[model samples]
Target: MKIALAQTDIMWEDKKANLDIAETFIKRAAEEKVKLILFPEMSLTGFTMNVEVHGEYYETSSKNMNNDKSHWNFNRTLDAIKQLSIKYSINIGIGYIEKELEESKGKNKYAVISALGEVISNYTKIHPFTFGTESKYYCGGDKISYFNIDDFKLSTFICYDLRFPEIFQIASREAELITVAANWPKARINHWVDLLKARAIENQCYIAGVNRVGHGYGIEYNGNSLIIDPLGNVIGNCLEGVEGLIIAELDVDLVHNLRKDFPLKKDRRESLYRELAGEIIESIH
Candidate 1:
């Protein structure tokens, strides 16, 4: 599968401007014939806390999540991206705020739309960045989610979720590729690459991490978007501190063959880990 990492310069809290920028990137990637293109977290609006104004209503149960725009809270960002996906004949992985009725907060979500512009996998961030006060405004997801292209399955995750490996490990049980859409700051970019390498090596699956570049909320995000192989090798990078695209051709057969040769997942003790964790939590109490 040929995929693209679109490192973008997001306009802070501005959906319209960001969408225009995203459209240009989409058009460019389509011309390159990229099968799937992934954007950073909060693709349109930069990592901002202005959800009340920017948040879009989502029909959590709808099969055609992107096309069903009848909800009064639905916004233009969703509509534009769906049309872009269909018009360009390509799949898109984008991030947006999903307003939740219960908390009046939202879920930081990454959703995948098929080439036909049908919603495939709509994943919520499993870990909200409590350090950044994201937990106060967003609810964490309880499960991992995936989308398929033919027989190839790719699990989805968001920014802070990458710090927790347990979810990625669980997702790897059935997925060959993991997509992490993040807006991680420039100061801790080293951690980003190192963690991604570790996840790819441990899970024996391809990791595609797409991040944004430029400024947001007065913080710098130097895009070090990468496509790493299961062997923990950095096969693709779109240059640091700039907005660009990294194109990579991933082979699922490589994952299958590598796992057959290495057979690492066969040795994982899931129940043992759970038992140990349970005892730790009980002891703390």
Candidate 2:
């Protein structure tokens, strides 16, 4: 399948402008016959902590305006994106802050929309960036999610989730390609690139890391969005400090063949790891 990573420069808390930019990228990707287009974390809004502005309401109407806040105006943007995806006949993966009716707080979520305008997979970020104080405003998700597109089994994870390999290991059990949407800063960009390669190498799957460029919340981002194959080779990259699309074709057979040849997962000692973890927990108690 052909996939495109949109390394965008998010307008700070400006939904309409960002929506327009996102559409432009989606259209360009469609012209290349890309099957899936991915955007960075908080694609519409620069990583802002102000929930009142960027947070979505539990129940929102595209026509109704409860207030003038950007959060309340997200439904309209979502509707527009859905229409664009249907019009272009392309799948889309975008990130946003979603508010649930059952909970008072919102969660960082990545929504995967099919070409037919159907929401096939909605994954909330399991690990919020605590160092950035994201945990203070958004609730963390508890589980990972996977979905399929034709012959490819795909999964998604947010920015900080890349640091945790256990979830990737679990997802790799069923997923051939994994997508990561991030708002990572330029200061730690080396870590981002290294971890992405590590995850792909360790899991024997394709990894796509889509990150943003430009400055946000007083921090600058050097877009190092990348696509790595199972052998940890970078098939495509957007490079640093550029707002553009990086396209790559992924082969599912490569994943299967590499896993079969390496057979690393078959030798995992899960029982030993669990016992050691239990012992550590007991000692802490």
Candidate 3:
């Protein structure tokens, strides 16, 4: 399948400008005939945690009040995606913050809007980063989620969720391709690259990561968005701070071939792993 990673810079709370850019990118990706296009974390409004400034209640029909402070306003964004999907005839995965079930109110949770323009599944980040107590602003996702597009079992993880291998392991068990949409900063470029490769290698699945560019909230981003094959080889990537679509062709059978040759999944020591809960788990990257 042809997948395009839209490595665009977020507008840092500018929803209108961000939506405009998203529409343009969708048009560009459609022109290239991409089957799936992935955007960075919080693609519509960037990764600002200021709920008062960026959040709004989302509904099918609601007033566009600038002062409205809810979790997020996803109604407009969803309508845009529906229109674009019909126009482009392609699937898209974009991230955003949304008001959770009333039982989940006052917590932080990010959601991925599906290609059909409906929310197929919503995953709150399982591991929220604490460099600034991000979990405080959002509710953490309870479990790994996966969905199918054609014959592919696809899964997703948010920014800090990339650091946790257990999350990918769960997803990879059923997923042939895993895409992580992140707003990672520039200082951890090495970690980002290494971890992405590690995830693909360890899980034996195709990995596509979409990261933002430019700067936000005084933090600079090194946009090394990458697509890795099942063997953990980089097939395509973007340079830091560059704004463009990075496209790569991936095969579902390659994942099968790699796992067949390596047989890592079948040879797993799951019973022993439960006993080593406090011990360290190292990646093969």
Candidate 4:
């Protein structure tokens, strides 16, 4: 299947403008015959800690939202995205903030929507970036989530979750593709590039890292969006500081065949690893 990574320039706290920009990329990718499109985190808003100003509510892990058109969802950014997916006949992986009961903070979430507008996977960010004060504005999730599409098992992760390899290993146990939606800045672009390749190599799966390009909250983000294959090859990437689509075709069977040929996972002793990292696996529940 072919996928497109939308490296866009998000306007700070402006949902309307960002949605318009996202639609343009979706239309272009659809014309290019892209099956699935992935967008950076906070698709309709830049990386801002203004939850009270920009937080929107949608159904949490609800599959019936496609059939039942709620009033707020019908007019909001997610509804617009759903309409675009149905119109373009493509699936989408995007990120946003989920409004919970808390007034000051929200849940950082990434979702996969099918071509028919079905909600496939709703994953919340497991590790909030404490260095950037994301922990104060975004609540972390307890569990990981995955979905199946086009005979591929796909998992979702947010920006800071890329630093944790144990969760990636656990998710790769079942997932053949891992999608990361991020708003990473320019200063640490090297780390973003290096960790993405490491994740793909160590986990033996496809990694799609989508990021924004322009400035947000005084931080410049030169988008280093990338797509890598199981053997640690850079299959798709775009020039830094540019806003465009990074397209690639993924053969899901390669992941299955590679694991079968190498069989590196068989050497892992799950019991011993669990004992070494006490209460880590227990927290997944």
Candidate 5:
């Protein structure tokens, strides 16, 4: 499968400007015959906690519903991208802050839309960046989701979820390709690169990490969007301090062959590990 990583600079809290920039990248990726294109975390807005301006309303009544107007700018952005995906016949993965009526706090999510312009998968970030006070504003998700695109079984994750290996391991059981959309800063870029490779190697699955470039708020993001093979080799990289699209072709057979050869997952002792971890947590508490 051919995939494109859109490494671009996000305009701070400017959805209109960001959507315009994203449209250009989507068109360019389509021109290259990219089957799937992935964007960074909060693709339309920078990592900001001001939910009132950046967040979209979850509920829309008929009284407020106009074909011309949306309850949230994020909805309009998705509408445009869905149309573009259908027009280009390419699958698109977008990261955004999703506002849900049940949860007024909103959550960080990534949605994958098929070439048919239908939402195939919607995954909420399981881990919120508490250090940055993200947990205060955004609610963390409790489940992992996987979807199918042609022959590939894919899973999606957001920025801070990259640090958790257990979730990747769970997804790897059924997924051959994993996508990570991140807003990782330059200061801790080394961690981003190392963790991506580690997940790919340990899980024996293809990993595509799409991170943003340039600065957001006061933090500098170096892009470093990467595509790693099952053997932990970097097949496609955006390098540091660059903004553009990076494309790579992934093979499903490679993941199968590697797993057959190594069979590391089959050897895992999940029950024992869970017991040990539980004990440790209990002891700490």
Candidate 6:
């Protein structure tokens, strides 16, 4: 499948401006006839923990964990996906803040919507950086999710989720492509590059990591968006501070061939892994 990754500059804490920029990119990708286009994490608003300032009142009244009746422009993001999909006749995946559940103190939730404009599934970030009150502002997602688009099985993950390898494993079991949307900074560029390739090699799946560029809340980012092939090669990438579309063609045959040759699934020692997981959970509890 041909997918276009948008590596663009964000409008810090400004939802409208970021949406405008994203729209322009999406239009361009459509003109190029890209089947799927991805946007970076928190694309509507730059990564900021000021929930009180940016968070919206998301309730059932919103009809889909979003209430546009309250003048929530962020809610329009969902509509944008549906409209874009219909207009361009392609699938689009973008990240945004959702309304919170009652048990959670935070009003913001992180979610990824599909081309049909339906929220295929939503993942509250499991690990929130405590430095900027992310934990206080956003609820955490408990489990990993996977979905299918045409012939390819795929999964979605936000920033900070990359540190955990097990999550990738969970998705890899069913997905041939794992798409990670992030706001990762320039300082950890190495980690981002390494992890994307590692995930492809270890899981035998294509890895598409879409990260944003520009500065936000004193944090500067150099968008190193990448599309890693199943054999663990960087096929397409954007360098530091560059903003544009990184298109790559991913073939399902490679993933199938690699898994058949390596057979990591059949070789896994689940019994030993259960014991390890038990020990870790016990220690945390």
Give the per-residue Cα lDDT of candidate 4 at 218: 94
* Worst lDDT 10-window in candidate 3: 100-109
lDDT of 6 by residue, 1-285 (tens): 888999989888887888778888888888887778898988878887766555554344345544444543345666666776776676777777665433344423445455566666555666776665777767677877767776788888888888888888888989999988899999988999999889889999999999999998899999999999988899989777989899888788889998998898888897999999899999999
Q: State model 1's lDDT.
A: 0.89
Q: After superposition, how far is residue 214 of candidate 4 from its true place, in Å?
A: 1.0
**Model 4 C-alpha RMSD to native:** 4.0
Tell me which of candidates 4 and 5 scores higher on TM-score. 5
- Misplaced by over 4 Å in model 4 are 59-75, 102-104, 279-285
Between prediction 1 and prediction 6, the one with superior lDDT is 1
Give Cα-based local distance difference scores for all models: 0.89, 0.89, 0.79, 0.87, 0.87, 0.79
Candidate 3: stretches off by over 4 Å:
56-74, 100-115, 278-285
- The C-alpha stretches of model 1 lying farther than 4 A from their native spots are 59-71
TM-score per model over all chains? 0.94, 0.93, 0.87, 0.91, 0.92, 0.89
Model 4 TM-score, 2 decimals: 0.91
- What are the clashing pairs of model 1? none
Candidate 1 structure quality by residue, lDDT tens digits, 1-285: 889999999998888888888888888989999999999999999888887877776555344446546544654566788899999999999999987444577889888988898889888898999999999988888988977986589999998888999998899989999999999999999999999999999999999999999998889999999999999999999878988988998899999999999999889888999999999999999
lDDT by residue (tens digit), candidate 2, 200-232: 999999999999999987999999999999999
In candidate 5, position 56 carries an lDDT of 56
Residue pairs with colliding backbones in model 4 are: none
lDDT of candidate model 2 versus the reference:
0.89
